[model samples]
Target: MKMIIATLAAVVLMTTSTVAFAEQFEVINTEGSSVPGCQVTNSCFIPHTLTISVGDEVIWKNADVATHTVTSGTQRGGPDGVFNVSPFFPEDAFSHIFDEPGEYPYYCLVHPWMKGLVIVQDAMADDDNAETTPPPDDGDQKSQMDEQRATPTYDAEHFVTTWIISTPGESIIIPTGELTGTYSVDWGDGTITTEAGNAIHEYDDAGNYTVQVYGDFTSIRLGGDPTNAVKLHSIDQWGMIQWTTMESAFRGASNMVYGATDVPDLSNVTDMSHMFAHAHSFNGDISTWDVSSITDMSSMFASATSFNQPLESWNISSVTAANGMFRGASLFNQPIDSWNTSSFMDTSFMFLDAVSFNQPLDSWDVSSVTEMSYMFTHATSFNQPLDSWDVSSVISTSSMFWFAESFNQPLDSWDVSSVIDMERMFESAHSFDQDLSEWHIIPDGT
Candidate 1:
């Protein structure tokens, strides 16, 4: 009985030791280490590599002043799942548990060059089996992994296409399987006279269609004036182009000439928001556009990388929504003080990732904005007069200036009395210094 009891005691000690050993994976940043390779000084993990076992958790503690993220693998790196830890603040820690056996690599979406790999090994697999499997083929594995991570690809041809419209009162059938074509309109009865042409095409078909009104620039008349003037009076009578097909139509005739100077005529356009949001090569001047009827300007130029038209002259006094309006527009740098955004609520990423904008927005009224999280994040050089703006209504300022490297303006005038989460608000802002002595923090006694 005594021998059996001693054996059981020994087994309990061994089990405890194993449990403690299993939870031993830890990630640390080396002090004063700025080297750019694996095992930089005291840091165990580099940009894209970490090794651990099943049931083990890896904790990432930010030691440097610069913010870092652990986003899923991108184009340069390998497969990384949806788990992301971004804008990690100094002393802030994030832990992820590895339950399965696989190699997971991640990168910093904000800083793409930073990479890290997490290898989860099976507790039961022998060391010999692990060594013999050979590191997964980087070429084939990357392709397969990318396929799994691919977002739905949109076909432009399926939505927008060309067509021909016959005169004032004729039903035109669109050619089958043709995604696009030119539509020529000729006054059928001649009573309307092809010389005094002002005909509209009605596309009852459900898909996106690029309707091109072909006419002599010197032949058409609007008010009996012999000027090649085109007018789309109403939204109902005007052609409707959905977002899905807009890309294809824009690309097909992306370089097509329209106006007198080969410019596209958008003077009568009421809703200009989201018109060219995802258009890659839509580099036309719509500075004189009448956008007085537009209310939502959200995501209007979100990812338009090459658009640099001067739209400061546009009449956007009626625009109420500017959410994500300039999210990823890296080239546009025109003044937008003409916009009337009194009704905006969510300005979360209004200028996030916009690297070239450095204008003064101190005169605008942002009293109604609630979410300012990441509003100016990654806007490298956007440091100017924003001191007059009201931030009393803001709630989430979590990542408001996470990676704004060149933002060093004084924000003492901001009323953050209503803000809740201030975590990582100034993280990775390599050049940020604002006095927060006036900010109303919750009383320590209360």
Candidate 2:
């Protein structure tokens, strides 16, 4: 089952500027070493070394849990005047351009042993002719070499794209060359629209935002502060896409995304435990997402107070844990009777303080669940049918219905033989007057 065994570690660095570039090279810091070509014990920067033209750019992306730097120079020599990175966290990246022809060796200040090299070459040296015509205009004027390099190279997996904040609360997006399709845009402020000439948008407040674009697109990276958007609107094909398909794509966003109309496909997602833990403004229509691949749904909607959408059609057969799935969700009372809970092993605090939940779950198969402690603590409106549930596998039912004022269901037939704790099972259940003469209780560790 999908589980969040460790928290995602990173330090996000914000930027207020953008730069144009030519060919772009990527170096990812994954696991303990760089990937795609880099290895540890010897060469740490995948490719270890690289050769590029004077105008090319190289981007270093952090894919590990720890921080990494791309300081220019070796450990003993210290940092050079070339480049250096501020503490960048997981999924963070930094780029630099080479304009001079020379050999530059770089290393990571955090991990002194990690190193890399970049060799810059003169543009004219690439031509076969010893003395090329007019020295091939170099940025000073338009030349034949410039036209040759203009031919765009598109990736089968990712379409070339770029975006920038046009002004306060607005952004200008450009999907250049080869990629053609009417796309939909989610401004990340409870608003969505279609892409026109140069996709533009405005936001309500001034803060960091992630603009999501979908349609004939495979990869999306919209990073900017859309504080200067206009009120123009249009529609396109956005129903076929699911925005969270990529890995850890929207980890800690608060009000950045809202409404069900903007979420894309989720058939391939595995870990979504804290996807929206503290997102207090998300009440979107994501009931149609395929959640069969998910295993860890703990705290998925913990503090999302405005969410009350229907999720009865979701297939949760592979789920194994839902520790705090609805801890503080105060307005969720949807019918989830059709959920497949046979593989659930942990439901601790699943509905800790959900004051408005009272759905029927009589047909649920919960034979594999072992922890139901505080499952319905403080759930004032929950009084549903759960008599047919096979909870013989549960080990902790302490405070299971504590403070559940309206829960008066008859549980005399339940096999509580395996429960090791039953303290405060019905502590403040003012409405519970059912007979418990047939209960088979036991203490912790016999």
Candidate 3:
């Protein structure tokens, strides 16, 4: 009888020990348990409070149907970078071992009202481990606040001083100020020249010819042989041209700045996108100004019917898009082989109907481009070497080579792995006969 009692006592003791050691909980998205402020709909966590010892592991099994995150902080404040466990799917379990004794307040990221707390108590208080330096200063640390409320520098109220001077019969464009780099001038008459101080030219007839300058000059004025005809043209109404300082100040003056002979200070401009988009008469020397801060160059020279200038010295690394940039610009064909196009993403409709752009772009880094639809459509004179371009990231090639009658380069070396939409890609491309049997086409274009 005594032996039987001992065996029964041993079994009961073993069951109690197993229950005490295993600290487990479940997170449920159900009605709250009768706690004071915890409600049914908002109380995401099943048991909102838990107590555990140091060196003990806690397992949280998600019983909710939706995903939940065990982030550390209150709903009003942001995350505290503590133990953040997220994406706990239905029936998924997450475990974490407590190494220190402290009160850890946690809340769900998705459901902020579903708050919980884990109170960890030391198994044994060691005096030597308790005495340490003070915690870090919260005030000294950098706050991870949103930066959208910062002060803006570029307001539309400020006006940039610009003047227009036209020379009726003079055929000479002279560089006056202390010129540093080499200045290139496109004489609008299909003639390009490089000079230091004074650039002289002879026009075949007396017609309005826009001369483009490509050098650095500050505080210089342009005049037409001491004639009143070289006065400031109409300043026009200040429209949506928002800028802090105009680098290409008169870029918005379409075709009017063509008569101006002086170059403005373009050293402080940041946004040069669409600056000379429709400036049909502006063939000035702007090749020497600093353009490092310029971000958007989308359609900078689009529809400029008579612009064919050399832009090889330009550093376009900071530009992000060139969409419809040179579209309908019939006379632009200069050597832009040295331009850095690594940052451009959207080149869609960039060279649409540009019939005279056939420069060699074999060395341009177009690896980041994702859209090339309508890029070379209607560009009849583009037959340069583009076989070595890395087109793995391009998604849409629809109507890319449409109506390109002069493009016959072998594109067998390009990686067209990521292209999804290729509808009408080579339609009307009478000159494209290269074999494309190795292209990996996606089934559903999503």
Model 3 ranges off by over 4 Å: 1-254, 257-268
After superposition on all C-alphas, the RMSD of every candidate to the true structure, in Å, is: 22.8, 20.6, 28.8
The Cα error of candidate 1 at residue 119, in Å, is 57
Model 1 residue runs over 4 Å out of place are 1-273, 442-446
Instruction: Give per-residue CA lDDT, model 3, range 256-317, as digits (tens).
Output: 32212233334455555565655544454556655666766666777766567677888888
Candidate 2 off by > 4 Å: 1-253, 256-263
**Greater-TM-score candidate between 1 and 2:** 2
lDDT by residue (tens digit), candidate 1, 187-264: 222222122223444444321123333323211112121111111100111122221111112222111111111223
The ten-residue window of minimal lDDT in model 3 covers 1-10
- Backbone clash pairs for candidate 3 read 211-283, 212-283, 212-284, 212-285, 213-284, 213-285, 213-286, 214-285, 214-286, 214-287
Which candidate should be chosen as best, given lDDT against the real structure?
2
- Whole-model Cα lDDT per candidate? 0.51, 0.61, 0.58
What is the TM-score of each predicted model, taking all chains together? 0.44, 0.49, 0.46
